[model samples]
Target: MSDLLRRVATPCIGVCSTGIGDDVCRGCKRFCHEVIHWNSYSQEQKRIIDERLDQFLVQVMQDKLHIINAELLAWQLGVQRVRYPAQKDPYIWLFQLLRAGAGQITEPRKYGFVVDSVWRDSSLMELREAIDREFYLLSQAHYERYIGRYMQKEG
Candidate 1:
């Protein structure tokens, strides 16, 4: 079969609870509308959305973790049996790294990462909390902007 004929797998982390008023998916960080309409989107459109999510993840994660050698990191992930999206986004890998390493991450450089001092100094739970807070704020802002346009149009 042609590669183009194969559909790209959805990045659904399986925590899809978009039934509420959440404008974003908590697991994958995809916009709720994007999640709902994913199966209907053309490959090019899906790619575009994936790229946007990648950009957002990188923007948020770069402040907390720095990737050194992406190839080495991928190798390490394989060795550790850590599951993450296979996309080229380093930030997603970093998320997996953080989850896998947690308290065990004493020398992040060895894992091809350099976590922020704030994260490095704190417990993994603390880091996770901070990341969640930041991501939630970002999602809320995006939701307001997206919904505001529709609200404005109706008024």
Candidate 2:
């Protein structure tokens, strides 16, 4: 589908932590206001939000993983029926695979990636948590630097 015709999918994985009043959600790594207002956002707004998230995941994975085979990664995501946005950066697809079931994967090579040498020894489950933690923190930092600053100035 064309970008204009296609809707940007919500990042929610059904593990929302925003109800407890978190500034950023743990599941999708979106700011709390973003989650609450997602359905109301215009297509362009949604796309911007999605892009920010994709960039965050890409940043977190940059040092920790390497996609050596883009074709294989695409094929594996399809073969495994991983739910990811098509036509996105391959790193986003890699993040989706990790989010869906990192532990289920034993040899990332089969999925077309190799964990960095430093993280190769870590269990995929552990790696998944670390990635998630970093992503959330990064989102939180951005929110504080931008939104929070705006709010503080306005208040």
Candidate 3:
């Protein structure tokens, strides 16, 4: 479990092509210019983009949660056909990590899925145990990466 919850960095390799109308790259899902000049952007500019990305990510996760909750309701109502909730939406924790900006601007999808899948199957106490373990590990990693970047200034 601890091994499955490790953090990884953003996988962007500078391949960016913003869509024609949306101004966001279909390849990297960021504005093309932001992708092109990511290395050159000031910390302030990067932080702004990161914040917007966080919001977009949260919305994506919220949509998944809604879909999962609706499916759970349907199952409870004795729907004739029900999709596997685990397969349908298994990345909720990843979205939480994105919102929290763990690892200083990265999404460790593999670990996120492992934790989320475990969470979906566990009872309340079991889930809480998993969350506590995963959160403690991940939070420590986040602290190591970002506390010096932001919090130490205040300290």
TM-scores of the candidates are 0.79, 0.91, 0.34
Q: Rate the local accuracy (lDDT) of all candidates.
A: 0.75, 0.89, 0.41
Please give, for residues 1-85, the per-residue lDDT of candidate 1 as tens digits.
4545656668787887677766777877777788899999998888777776667667788888778888888888888888877
lDDT per residue, candidate 3, 1-155, as tens digits? 24224332232435444445434454334554566687876666765655554444444444332233433333432332323222222333343333333334222232322224424444434433444344334433444464434654776
Q: Which stretches of candidate 1 lie over 4 Å from their true place?
A: 1-7, 85-87, 100-103
Among the numbered candidates, top TM-score falls to: 2
lDDT of 1: 0.75
Task: Rank by TM-score, highest first.
Answer: 2, 1, 3
**TM-score, predicted candidate 1 vs. hidden true structure:** 0.79
Which candidate number has the best lDDT?
2
Ranking by lDDT: 2, 1, 3
**Global CA lDDT computed for model 3:** 0.41
